[model samples]
Target: MSAKVQWFAKDLLIIGAGFAAAMHIGKLPAAIPILQAELGLSLVQSGLLLSCIQCAGICFALLIGSYVSKLGLKRCVLLGLSLLTLASICAGLTQSVLSLFSMRIIEGFGFLLVTLSGPALIRELAPIQSLPAKMGLWAAYMGGGVGIALITAPMLIQSWSWSVVWFSYALITLSFLIGIAWFIPNTTPSSQAVPLKSLIKLTLQHQPAWLLALIFGTYAGQWFASVGFLPTIYEQNHIAPTLAGLLTASVSIANAVGTFICGLLLQRGLQAKLLVILGFVVLIACALLFYTAKDSLPFMLQYVLVFGFSLFGGLVAGSIFAQALHFAPSPMAISTTVGMILQCSALSQFLLPPSIALLVSSTGTWLWVGVLMSVLSILGIVLTQRLFAIQPKTSA
Candidate 1:
């Protein structure tokens, strides 16, 4: 990569690790069709499979934060990547649905570790001037990785199988582990252990912490629920699988594009909260146009609207990451704050996909998905205002 691309070397490493982990996460949605065929998974089971990797985060984000802070970020990153490497390798060897579910749960723990610790690592290593831009890029990890995976998985699976895709991810994660070790400077793990009760008390005591977490959750719920099912949704409309994957991938990349723009805006000193509110406005408008007007409009128009929803909807993520740095109670509390947000985001991931799947399964249409997304966007708008109400305090 060019030095301009690696503006912050260590930050780039952390983002690279995150991108690989996200690819592991994103690989699943594209492979869902093959897994369903091979494993005989029901609609709910498919949704569960899509989200099961978040199960550990849902339950242990806060607790993991405390532990990771004690263990150190580098150690956490290595350990998490190792687990994913192993879990993906095992998943490639498995054929049974039960085995796949169990492996995903393991991957869940791995995903949680990298993501929760990554921002804190970036905050430590990044130059002051570059933090906002780096964080904005950090926010795009999921969308970018998922977008790439969505585009590539179909092509890979057509020649081979889902297991091969899983194996390829394992190799990729292993390569990242080696890169992180070689290129990233090492830091000693903290000996100090913040008591669990104290950590929770400190994080929960802050109002911005709660609001940030809620905002992240609501934003992530809509994003994941919609994107996770896009390929399937298009399939039902009789789009070719390759074409569907391409379109879905493009939508996700649009999210990353918006995130990149938002990052540049943050770097230029834009009001972070205002960006989030604008994002929610775009999300609501796009949802109305895409989800509600699908049947009435031409298919390509529907596609364009969904693309717009994701493109602007991405500003929420970038804004949230920017605000999160300011909202952190202290430098030490950054991981904790991130954990709390991820916990909320993970819970949304766990709940929203299955919930959306059930809605589609029960109602037999994508009509109400827009309504759910609209409600969440409205909630996000209300919550965004509260984020700016409190003057951000300096965290040591």
Candidate 2:
């Protein structure tokens, strides 16, 4: 195949991987309640499912970060999709949290494989000048998949059962795996493969990478804490229980829109630092409205506040990921850096939901949750904008 044709083929395969990953985010909400009730699990137990996904990512990213240059993208993605299929089916069949954890060990690694290679794959398939734009679209589509899953999964579970949720996601994984097997182009010329040796570099160990990791992690923790518990909160408020599905799903859609906007602006010379700064600004506004004005606001406005806050919040999740790819020391190192960032984000995903649940279980109001979001947002802003003179740009 011609170089252009080969690159486009590989791009499609990468896109399929992203679609599969995005769907996993949507699958969690529906699974949480079912797992809690089915296995007599606590909110903490449910939170670990997310933890497993990130855990695998963290470990694998370090081991395999630069492996793309050696193993090639097609082989790595094939392995992940196969594992993803197995994990989804296993998670669907398992009756206990123990079984779920066992299966998630597989799922988490699969996710890591997919994510760590994402930016590297894009770089291989697209021109150097198009990296930001391509990564942005990739982020949008991935976020959109999460949105689609959020909207669809709840209604299915409402009518069916929790097992159906996992099975359904399994189907998505299976289909994507097949597509990837059929169409992902072979690995093209590698730019620079980041070696594990450089991981020992003190400058990387110290400043920009870790600090940026924390910023992403904190922002994600606050956002997930809110999203993970939203269903229960909806139930508590006696609003439509489906509102959780609608809201989470819609926010995903909004996030996609935001990411897309960011991609467009980035192409026009928008700064990554500015986007991070603006994200915190929006999060602060959301916290104030969510805390102080929440009760007084009408239902529509409530939706608007949640949606608006989440739109930018979701943007942070995707765009930061894209940025990680951008700053990657080399193609081979994509997994290492992206894995670290995802690990931090995933740690936040693991910890915050249970923390918020415990607090709310004791305190009985979302008031303090708002305070948490505000604080995290401020911290993220400080950390992201620190030392780096360029302002992080926001997606739309």
Candidate 3:
């Protein structure tokens, strides 16, 4: 193969690994009903299952990132994929909720390793001119992985069982693990290892990194809360499992499309700040219309609103990931900065969905969920403005 083709192939492999890792997350929403019936789980317990995959990210993303930098990105990615493969298989065998939840927590660690390392590795591999577009593609991994899993898991579950879904994902992750090991070049670690304390200081001291963290956190929380529960929401409305999965998958795939477009726009010299602000505006409008007007509006219109919300939310994510490369204090700190952002993003994902579930349970309404999302979307707009104010003059 040509050298250019080789480079592109390696980048694709890394992104594929990320997508495989995310399938562990997407597989659960489709299985929630089966789990509730088979395991006798409560709605609160189901919410926990959905959010617990972020546990390691909530607590250890920065530490993992610091060590990943010292360990070499290729090695960390391999180790991450291995963990995911193992965890998925183990989760498939579990007969109790506690055992399954424990395995999911391990999956979170694996997810952290791949996601934190993938972008930094891409920055090292891609030409400067192609970096933004590549990062945008990297940003699409979650939505793409989740969308495919949502669509396929239901079919797998109906044909067999939820355990089959888990086992299938394990096999898929293993395939990517082997492909990455064979195709990607070994990444060398830095000559000197930075201490965890220093890595945290370097990442936390950068104002733009913190702003990016908050912006990503708000967007991720709202997006996950809305999209993650979509299957359950549709199920409550008496929608068939197959159709619900398709609708939810459509929303997620729209997010992937938005992120890819955001990348192209960024490469063409569109301002990241403008894209982010536009994303927030669309999110706010969508949240109000979808959550508040559900009974009055046509079902298709409601789906359109949420689909738009996710698509524009992808624009926010792609812009943030692209800009993060510019704001890192040093080459070694790239993963650290991304980790800090992921930590906050994980924090939001951890907190938001369960909170929404509990509120809906208590009040018998989804209205406050819209209010919460609007508040966060406004916060995202303010943070995006402040983040750009401090953008390094040399940034593209």
Candidate 4:
């Protein structure tokens, strides 16, 4: 294919896969609670169900990067999506905790394949000029996927069993798998992959890559911290639990709006670093508005906090991922570069939000968490600026 044609085709293909992944992840909250209640699972067990997937994703990051030639991005994605579809169905039908745990591991492995290779393929197909613009669009799609999933999960659960929600999400994966199998080209390398240790060393040494990871981790931590408390805050203030879930869906979908807007901005010639800094600013504003205005404001404006928080939040999420991958041009090491950043980001996503909740308990308020977000977000902006100033052109 011509470079131009390949760029368009590859991006569409990647976005399609992202759409499927987003739907499944978005549905997690509604569906998991059912399984938890049904199985009488402890809090730790419930967390592991999610972490099991993260763990699988971690291992697949290295294995996929280290073996893309043998497995091929197309094959891996299709295989993973197929497994995801099956796993979703199996997860719905699981009769016991053990069976559910086994199914979650399968879902984890499948998700890892799809997530790691999707961006690597985009990096391969993008022309040098399109890096910033194309990446923005890619990020928008990921954020969009999250919105669609979260919004739909509640509606599905209201009318149908949570099991049906999983099965329905499976249909999304199945459709994506079929589309990918037919349209997306095989993207495996012909040569053996770089050694795992060497790939790690290369990415760790790449300043821009590591910086992007920190930026991603920082904003992701802040965003997750806000989002984690959003539902509970609403509930504590007397909003119905179901209403809180819907509110979560609203904020999540708003994140998609933020992503699409940022992507369009990048396409229109905005600088990536400027956008990253702007996102941090938005997050800080969101934090202050939510935390500082207890009774002064009317109910409606204060309630809009969720939308405001997620409104421009995704600008940070997708930009950093794209930037991290763009810092390296080697197809041989692209997987490792993306993997390392994602792994770090995933850690923050898992750890930081809970820590903030603990702060609320120990400190007797959400003030410390709010302060932590502001400080970290500021640091992220600083790092983004430094990286941009040092490596302006190539580190898109």
Best candidate, TM-score: 3
Candidate 2 global CA lDDT score:
0.70
Candidate 4 residue-wise lDDT, 323-365, digit = tens: 6665753556666666666676667877887788788789887
Error of 2 at 304 (Å): 1.2
The stretch of ten residues in a row with the least summed lDDT in candidate 4 is 387-396
lDDT of each: 0.84, 0.70, 0.87, 0.71
The order by descending TM-score is 3, 1, 4, 2
Off by over 4 Å in 1: 1-7, 39-44, 191-193, 356-368
Tens digit per residue, CA lDDT, model 3, 1-396: 998888888888888888888888889987889999999989989877877888898999888888878899989999999889999999899898899889988998999999999988898788788788888999998999999998899889999999999999999999989998887778888877677689888788888888888999999989988887675557557887668778889999899889999999999999999999999999999999888877777767877888999999999999999888888777788888889899999999878877888988998888888888999999999988888888462243
The digit string of per-residue lDDT tens for model 1 on 218-280 reads: 989888777766655576579976777788889999998888889899999998888899999
Cα TM-score of candidate 4: 0.89
Better of 1 and 3 by TM-score: 3
Native-referenced Cα lDDT, model 3: 0.87
Highest-lDDT candidate: 3
Model 2: lDDT of residue 199: 48
Q: Once superposed on the true structure, which residue ranges of model 2 sit more than 4 Å away at CA?
A: 1-9, 32-44, 58-60, 64-69, 93-97, 155-164, 188-206, 358-365, 390-396
TM-score head-to-head 1 vs 4, winner = 1
